[model samples]
Target: MAVVRPVRGDRVRVYDLQVQGTSNFFAGQVLVHNCLIVDDPHKDRADAESEASRRALHDWYSSTALKRLQPDRNAVVGIQTRWHPDDFAGRRLAEEGRLEEGGRWKVVHLPAVADAKFGADPLGRAPGDPLPHPKIPTRDRKALKAWWADMKRTSIVRDWHSLAQGDPQPAEGALVSEELLRLLRDSATKVEPQKIAVAVDPSGGGRDVAGVVGGFLGDDKRVWITHDVSAVMSSADWSTAACRLAYEANAAIIYVEANYGRDMCSLAIRTSWETLQRDGEIPENVLMPAIDLVTAKQGKLLRAEPVAQQMVQDRVRLRGLFVDLEREWSTWMSTDPDSPGRIDASCILTYGLIPEANKGAIVHAPLPQAPVSGGRGPSQVAGAYGRRIGK
Candidate 1:
């Protein structure tokens, strides 16, 4: 053992020491070992929420920290509170499955209150039971309940779920539920649809992926989502994709969100349709689906609420599984900085199919009808297009 004393100086020099057999040393009163320990890698809530920050942390762990570990003797451990879905804890869980599912890491999740939705609580507490605290007496149930109630009352829903519940997303805030979607899934073959539509949410040259989704109003009066081909693409590519989906679905109309570039958005679809016809992608005999420009007069959340309600009421069904689109719908939060493109397209598709869902949030205007050929009007063309595909 050695006696240590502090020395006063203008500038202090630091040195690293290697322990003999134990490979461990004492700093002040705490034991320092040769294992990697990451404690709250994110500086704050803002950093946790930033994608760049999360990437930087993950990069350092993968590129630098892991390399320093001793193959047999060292281990890695991360301790953090849930901040965002892409936070370190979340990224790890996503990359490597959860422990129960055979992940490499062992997770000990303790929420402020027990929520069965997350998983079984280690403390054996039932749902709604407050976590036991050493500072508070064990017998004080009333005090613990009051404390948790106050916390929930003061904190926002997202924060309460992330910080208190150890869950980044709460079902209360999501636009749709994966469970409900799964339950509504239809396994039967496609049936005749009264009307079909393709909806587009343009990227407007931003980082967002353009959203192109197709659905049909079935004889049962339910909106059935049949296609989702959202992707990061150029203007021409997305417009072409939207037009192609419309043609394949025999959609009577194509609805496009004109929030970013109103005239330009409609123009892109029209140009793509015309080009497809010229290139023989669409038959010359089949008239192009009518293009309707939808200008959003309300916030994204406000416009989406009615559609979400429609789903809850069993008015919306999935013809098949759309994994990526469903993920966006289930995990997207109202507080997220960027609006998810898939969800935007879905809202447009739903509102277009079920006009009653609009509720004044959107104003629709049809583009000038393509010159009718052979005495076929827009209505007659639409009727023809509405016929079931492959019938």
Candidate 2:
């Protein structure tokens, strides 16, 4: 094995190798073997960030690369610096269950700098300690710190954490930050809601999960997310789940996204509500929540941006920890291919609860107005308006 500089203007060429003795042999300057070695699987930064590119690499590895390995003899190895959370190495680790516990792969994670959050440093370095390098003398702690500081200063937070710390996070490009979510969670307290609603983003029997999230407008003018029943289910199942959540939360309205299946979404909820009432699942005294079909006139990112800003302004709270929903909020990016159903539903719920977040384009439903003196309250007005819209 050796490193040799290519001659200027050298033409690129490919050659086949046939080792005579050992499994390994020198090909040009580098040692080569029949064993599969995926070095920096992603082509570049853009490729690493792209979902399509990641999937392509994953497919090639699973379908093509694995087949090329010799049965019971040849080994597979992958080496890469962390990029996105869904990058090739990340996906491979997740698929093999190595992300959570011990699995097939023997992972040796060596970040340029140590971080305690990822686990103890393999080199026994404390958090913030730089990885030992010959270029920076071990005795020169000031030089080492200065070098890492320069690296961090030059790179974006996401890239610095991923490429340098080996802890990839959808931080810079993410719609919401985990830190903000945590702050909201810490400040949230149990308060009797003034108005409650359930929002749904139907999957329409597709592979995507149907999102059913419930939230309430607190007296403090903050929207608090209380429930997330999002799942991969049939039309009937999701509708039923949405209705059940609404019933449990005593939600005054059920807001369903109607961009795709306008009538189907509304009809499903109404049908489920009727079925629930007829079967005594819902008591006779409890009136069914008004079903309001909402249509989005803007792109998802545009619709969600206002709500994210509201979160930043401390207008959104979580009644408790919603793990999956929080994960979606913290990691979802505009460039991501698949629509995040949970986020969609949460945005709808937020827009419904905090009318200011709607920004006029994301929702078609009449924004519930504040109560006038000697008139119906906001909930009453909203319920009446919902009923009128339902009709």
Candidate 3:
């Protein structure tokens, strides 16, 4: 706990409220674990060994990598780390499943970036790790090397830990290249949304940025991103902002992650829609669109991989400039839980666009609202957003 001196000289206060003679946590009782991926044959044999080696090896990236390593243990592990070394959270999850005697413990390493669609690598590997130079364009190679050269001296955390090792935090690396982003962008006039959806990843309740992204199945058989209404708003404001994005997109469905407050988010979005209707914003014919609550079963990186591929394959296009959202996509490696709000929104949007993937996941409202008319431009919706939604 005594890590560094505070800047503002504000002392940390601690008060233990445990009743007298009540304690569960032990002191210095290290529980050695022989962990592996769920199905690692080598680890499976190792688990049967009477004196199994305490050492375990795996990279921080995806769980699929560990599946190749056969394992047998009562407890499975999945570590979400920015580095190779064990973090507090990883240890805590392990501790929860720690056995006093008989239960075999297996911890899986999960290396992920906030925006799987963007970043250094799946394992967060740098360019020059195993190669003198990667196959990047000459300009990009030079830029990367130059950035690294400057960053090594300037950066507190260098590539040795990230390049030679695993970790995305501290360095705060970029995921997507300029070419990739430019390639995904299209002329606003050329792209038109046929079936739109708004995706929201709320921050529960805080001054954190709420990701609100809208896009639709394009006429070109691609997913076209329309807008990014993400902002660092209060709970009330963000909820309304989310609905505003949905309204502006004329989205048939508003997909909200229920990991936070399912009821709270649902109510907030509905309230915003009702407000817009009261102000005669959307046409009366446009009934309240279906609100679908989603709960993510897979990791963020896994969920985002398909969407990333679509963008890389030129199957995803941006209708307009969303600078900040692009930055979030370009820079976030899944180190922090909530840094890449925009990217999270992208994952939700992509899932909704894929019919098979979205099957049985969405719950429609009984009363279907009228569809949005393409006659009016997004400007009217934007104005309504500014006055009422933001208000």
Give the TM-scores of the predictions, in the order they appear.
0.57, 0.53, 0.46
For model 1, what is the alpha-carbon lDDT of residue 22? 51
How many clashing residue pairs, candidate 3? 20
Q: Which segments of model 3 are wrong by more than 4 Å? A: 1-175, 188-192, 279-285, 355-391
Whole-model lDDT per candidate? 0.71, 0.70, 0.51
lDDT tens readout by residue for model 3, 245-351: 76666667788876667898889888887887788876555666677877653566555555655665566677766676665565454443444678877777767
**Top candidate when judged by TM-score against the true structure:** 1
Top candidate (lDDT): 1
- Candidate 1's residue-wise lDDT over 294-366, tens digit each? 7654687777767777777677777778777776776666665556788889888888888788773322221
State candidate 3's TM-score. Answer: 0.46
What 10-residue stretch in candidate 1 is worst by lDDT?
Answer: 364-373
Summarize candidate 2's per-residue lDDT along 105-203 as a digit string, tens digits. Answer: 656788887877768677898888888768989988889888988988877566677778877776456767766776667322435567789999896
How does residue 311 of candidate 1 score in lDDT? Answer: 75
